[model samples]
Target chain A: MHSPGDKDNGEIEALIQMMSRLPGLGPRSARRIVLHLIRRRAGQMAQLATLLASVAESSRECLACGNVTQSDICPICQDPSRATGEICVVTDVADLWALERGRAFRGRYHVLGGSLSALDEIGPEDLRIPELINRITDENVTEVILALSATVEGQTTAHYIADALAPTQVAITGLAQGVPIGGELDYLDDGTITAALRARRKF
Target chain B: MHSPGDKDNGEIEALIQMMSRLPGLGPRSARRIVLHLIRRRAGQMAQLATLLASVAESSRECLACGNVTQSDICPICQDPSRATGEICVVTDVADLWALERGRAFRGRYHVLGGSLSALDEIGPEDLRIPELINRITDENVTEVILALSATVEGQTTAHYIADALAPTQVAITGLAQGVPIGGELDYLDDGTITAALRARRKF
Candidate 1:
């Protein structure tokens, strides 16, 4: 039997360590979350565990577009109406989910898994770039929207994909750069302000 | 089959909602965490699920001390070496865990579940105060240290417990009010500075 002073709580410690590895949670937050879960073990904890297990066992990446789903093909890729001759390519499934939340794009998506990173030695072959190229020709795609971030890797990947798809004659476009929908001029960065000025339209 | 803009991802949405309810996590963080878990479903996510299930099914409050445990009694209460005639009382299991992390106290602990709250109609019967008084003679306890918070409810509970234990002939004590170990005098609150001055000891 160990005293409270002993640092040998196996299960609880393991839970905290795992939770802390999550994106937004640190060690302190993880400990607080674990304690909260323990207190609500009969209700929320049990429900969360059940949902996690279900998702873990069932959720799989779409074979066509790389979006997460309970089947071989994700719901977005499987939906026939979404094949509107346009494909929005993103770096990861999270980005895909974010686009889904916006509910403005009535098209499919291509998840690249990650951007081209020279430091990490990640290249076109490492992501779903080859799959995305094949998708353009196979699905009679008329346009491909590069919805990647404004980072160096994102730009490099977008340019590489555009050059590759040039022969296929598909209209390749990138997201417009300017002030964000709800952005204040005071908070807008210098680079964004410059881009917005240079890309001014005759409105 | 749903499109990228579809708002009917039931399972995924449910998972996000449940995760947001955890302490220190809001809806945005929950969405990020859910997407991360889904992406890592084959590894960390699966491990998390297994651990959550195991803990949810097994972890229970210690019958003797109200601390979280996997068995009837917590390790602290079961450990014969921890019968040091001193018991530190806390308002919650999280408080007990916090004290355990410090690892300076060698004695056992008693969890009160919550403090006295007249507004919420909580009294001694709502907490484990009666059990604490009974443990004095049962455990041959010589000292009862109130390690509750400095809040109004905590003080009220501490005072009530002290009065109740006055008949047991056991020494009732509260944690010292002073500047925290690493706190600076300049940044310290007026109440703490006053407490520290009143309790000043000669070198």
Candidate 2:
């Protein structure tokens, strides 16, 4: 950390080195993005710092779904109208927003936190799979939509969940979104997203 | 800012407000992202924060191309192999990375900082247009590949630049990525990216 009087080249180098470690960002890009944010600190960076600190203390995971929330339960789970007997499942929180962007889905969501990965040792216990089953009976859910990725791991996890919930007789489906050969929900366009949702067929 | 004894609500709210302002992120996504980062602070989040701080200090705009850099010139400009006499002109630093991911182009790049927009009182003077004109001759740049988005503003800026650098005798081409109507480079796949790059034609 730089002292009050030490805004020198060394300090700057240290900062850039640290920033390079961020996900989706390399050292070169990190250095660039950080500088841009800092130059606008008077208008943006300072505020980002303050928010980072505060959110650090106040936020938590949704108890029912894996969605991140400030309160014990996320807003989506709290809304009575959202309990539409259907819970769309996703890999990460980012995917949830992609669906929300089109303002289409009205049902609630159950974030898996991550997919079933044998290599990473990520199993059903690591995800919200157990909780998802419980929600089916507790919420009188009729369908469990699997809006997961089409990756090897993603499909594997989807099949596992389907088998797990087979006893409940719930209609399982996926986002017929024509998700590219290998793509995340985050990158799809609004129209593609709309089409994917509309064409969603039963799995 | 709050004293040690103050309740944490205000601090948390402040953080949410600042995060809401990030591109493609609103209060809700910001809150979730912040929460996710905090929960994994010891692992991923810690690394991200440390890196954020590091880049914040060392990162600066490349003197030659306006790309983010830790020194006078960015690595792209510094690399001898990248001097392919073709300089891809883009709207921002993000676009540069998107281009890099495609790995189809062997040329250096120029970050215009932003597009020319009269609605926001932004003009040629507001962007790096003057610098771009200067680079054509300085770098012996044979081509200026316009890889901007399909937004009305993006096209307008591209056209404006093509006209401004008319006398430079540089080949003025745009990425024919047939980029979806409103697609961004970041959202594209490597193959789609390559296709677009390969199909590029004269402006």
Candidate 3:
């Protein structure tokens, strides 16, 4: 019998292998997903294939900010109303999208594509640090908000950027570290509690 | 940044929505998968799309036992060596594939597609129960081993099948329920412990 895992079922097995390579999916879940898709082949499966092809053909990085986009420039970078003399620097497009979902930041963004990692040998040049410095003067930016993760590598990258852009004289700031909205102190981590206590402001 | 969630990025948003509908994926993970796919568009993404298309076009249910196959008859059903006069019945193709992976069951399989569910108004006609009965007689089967789940619906279906096949005078059996291999007694539930004790045999 040509079992689902058998080499004879090449396409199905290959599809499952490919799916398992995606983030948050493993071989078992990939097999289940493939089976579900196969059952709905006429509807979701066909549509998914079409969408993947189209997205693959069109999707590209925004030349200005390293954000994912269909055009050379992302919509936020192209929007005149959003050019508010402020740029929120993020470590990745996912983080940029997350900040956009909050709808609190109206300024444009600069996606570094990844954070500084000495162990991985990633440096400033490997990221968009040079472009960010150029944007400070070219775009007449007044403030730069570092909305990077609180991880050590993220902080190191933030510090490196702040030092590199020192000559540009742009006002550099970072996202506040404290208790998140609706977060309970009992469940909070030690570092978070310490940071929250140290950054206490007028209540 | 036409935010990925925005209507402007229609294809990307649609792809994420479709992916989120998969068994183990949600919106957040779907977005991550889509981003990962887009990043590897030239290679993995393209290959995945091609594989999905091919599988969707070729895959179908095995006419004999309802197992998923690329042709009308599944390989297991078509194989002469698998006609061992013993048919192992399962609730779904996933279960059938699981049994195949073990490589212990050399006989053929009968996929019921789903178990009996009174709440869902599913009846014997809805599943492949009638076809299974016909196969027992036509294939000169001697034993029917029910490899159903431990769920109430699975047990109900198994009992119903046994009663229906009683007239055929075929030997009917079920999978033994006990502590799973490598299971700790402390971690096992009450039902498993009771069944294991009742069915204890000389080691």
Ranking by TM-score: 1, 3, 2
- How do the residues B19-88 of candidate 3 rate in per-residue lDDT, one tens digit apiece? 9989989878898899889899888888888888888898889889998878788778878788899888
What tens digits encode model 1's per-residue C-alpha lDDT throughout A11-80? 8779989999999898778988988899888888888998998888888778899987777777777788
lDDT per residue (tens digit) for residues A117-184 in model 2: 88999999899899999999998999888988878888999999999999999999988957886777
lDDT of 1 at B141: 97
Give the per-residue lDDT digits (tens) of candidate 2, residues B40-67: 7455554554445455545678889887
What is the model-wide C-alpha lDDT for candidate 1? Answer: 0.78
lDDT tens per residue, model 1, B118-194: 99999899899999989999999988878777677787888899889989989877666574653322234445544
Model 1 clash count equals 0
The lDDT for every candidate, in the order shown, is 0.78, 0.75, 0.79
Pick the winner on lDDT between candidates 2 and 3. 3
Displacement of residue A177 (Cα, Å) in model 3 is: 2.2
Between which residue pairs do clashes occur in model 3? A75-B1, A76-B1
Error of 2 at B169 (Å): 40
Once fitted onto the true fold, the runs of candidate 3 whose alpha carbons sit more than 4 angstroms away are A1-7, A179-203, B1-7, B179-203
CA deviation > 4 Å runs, candidate 2: A1-11, B1-39, B42-203
Cα lDDT, model 2, residue B29: 59
